[model samples]
Target: MTKLRLRQLVIAAPGPEVADDLRKVFQLGKPFHDKAVAEFGLKNSVFSIGDQFIEVVWPVKDDAPLHRFLERNGGAGGYMVIFETDDIDAARTRLDGAGIRRVWNIDLDDIAASHIHPADVGAAIISIDETRPWGSWRWGGPKWKDEAVEGELSGAILESPDPNGLASRWAAALGIPATTHPDVTRIALDDDQTLIFQKGEKTMLEGFCVSLQSAMKALERADDLGLKSQGDTVWVGGVRFVLNND
Candidate 1:
């Protein structure tokens, strides 16, 4: 069975200003482009963070799927991680056989994409997009144009009620080897990316707090610009970070 690789990370926010917050606090550069996926009533910006992207999606319509997500998950956090696959249909077939349901399907001329909800996957939602488009297409809108630069994703920090169980499931689903750490389980991907799942006492979907390489520098810069720190965690503009205890 072909495995799905992590592609993009999603950050859900209540408004467009969150983009600015992410840029200033994380020194994340500029917005890549805007995607107006009409089918989903989604108008969003894609920001480049090395080879991966941080997608900020805001609902164009009150009835859009994003609106419902915000209502359920509350403000900002990692919403999903897209995966790359050679054949989406075949992947979908495999997921369906395992009783997973597709949440959305995006058709872009010759390419197609789909997402599996996190509730079914046991962690973050995963999307599958074809690689052919990356060879030709530019992401995002003109107003906030930027390009992806190469860098290691480092790893993902996820909190779940059953981290070991989730790690086992992902090991089978992603066809990767998983190792048990003192507090979290780590799954290393083919592209030098890692996924870490930490067991939390709660099942509710709380927002994630990312830690970048220059986080301390970013925090210092943010402080000079009037950003406040909550203990060691900083709240700059609107971008927030919490130290990963695990």
Candidate 2:
């Protein structure tokens, strides 16, 4: 079977404060700073949450795309959703027929990635990648297993004026089916991971659904750090991190 799974999420921040804040709230290990991102006029802090990653990137140059996204969104928020496939050629073939614009890409011995333009997809940037040794991700750094926390970013939420349309586009690109319901459109993946789209005031990443035992404790940490949080959710990088119900 072609194994494709939600592997990582990227958040855009105006500065490094959000990254530090995330570290404290989740009690996650120090970020794996990617020096390669500097080539795009950006600096990044990537955290390992189980096998999944949550990355924060800030602008270092005026002409950087990170700078433009920050300016447009008015601050830190969800920027990208990444999926990894066990079959590289299959993933590429699926994306090729989607008719979406690719803004950036990288090909290496261990991995390859393509970034879909936000304008074509609507909501956030979409990245689909394939890596050697399967389940491994290069952007999370070589020693990412050491930085892992007791949680996983198992699902993502996107809010849009046209949820159905956006969800369909994402589904087609990933070579998955989009199932529509009364209030949402969903693409179900392996291990119960899901991508959901809903109607909202603005089109953007609204939150993540996470699986963790210390979820309430994380909320307390968010409160201690003076971040806006309540119930089973905490606000980080201007997006909600919601504890998974299951």
Candidate 3:
């Protein structure tokens, strides 16, 4: 197959305070570590969510990428989604052949990672990373085994201004067939991962939910931490979201 599975979803916030709030609500244990990035001189906090991660990058200065994103989106929503591919080079070759350009590449010996800009993907920036048995060097955080959650990520629902068009493009790019239901359009990939693109009147990041197995249980756990729950979804610190009921 020319496609890799959706492995992780990333959310970028304006500052570490928002990130820390999310961590507390999601009960995402302590951050893996504090690190500095050369590009924006921003400090980044990485957290684990299954085999995926939730990375919060804060700018050290006024004119950083995180600042730009905050100015554009006004707050947090869905930032990025990462995929795991067995052959990074081959995937890059295919995307290039299709006239896609990579935004950047991370070379850390153990893992090679690259991102295609959001404009290319019709929405969020998509990152592709390949790793050996140990893992990717560019990704340093708590291991998946350490996280209390279980089961592979089922999928993420995205609210889009142009849901139909975006859904079609994603179906082709990710090699997943698109299926439409009464309320939403879905693209199903392997490993039980899916992307649901829903049409929204506004471009706000609200009104979407993540599907997991134990919705009620997860909601209770989140509530114990002063989080709020509605139906099967838990809203943590007004940012992080956890859903056990599909």
Q: For model 1, how big is the CA root-mean-square deviation?
A: 4.3
Using lDDT as the measure, the top candidate is 2
What's each prediction's TM-score?
Answer: 0.76, 0.96, 0.81
Which one wins by TM-score: 1 or 2? Answer: 2
- Report the C-alpha lDDT of model 1 over 1-246, residue by residue, as the tens digit: 554556566677777776676677666766754555656677666766555666776667778877766776556556677667667777767667777778877777655777777777664677777665552333433333245433334456666788888777666555466899787678886555677777776432233345466556666766776767655577532233553322
Off by over 4 Å in 1: 1-4, 107-110, 133-146, 203-215, 224-246
lDDT of 3 by residue, 19-109 (tens): 6665665556556644546476677777665565666666687767767666777665566777777778886776787777788887666
Cα lDDT of model 2 by residue, 1-246, tens digit = 877789998899988988999889888887899999999889999999888999999988888878888888889999999988877677666667677777788889999888888888788998888888788888999899987877788899999998999898888778889999998899998778899999998899989888876678888888888899888889999989988532
Name the 10 consecutive residues with the lowest summed lDDT in model 3.
Answer: 202-211
What's model 3's overall lDDT?
0.64
In model 3, pairs of residues that clash are 215-244
Q: Assess each prediction's global lDDT (C-alpha) against the native.
A: 0.62, 0.87, 0.64
Positional deviation of 164 in candidate 2, in angstroms?
A: 0.5
Looking at model 3, how many pairs of residues clash? 1
lDDT of 3 at 240: 40
| Candidate 1 vs candidate 3, TM-score winner | 3
Cα displacement (angstroms), candidate 1, residue 92, comes to 2.2
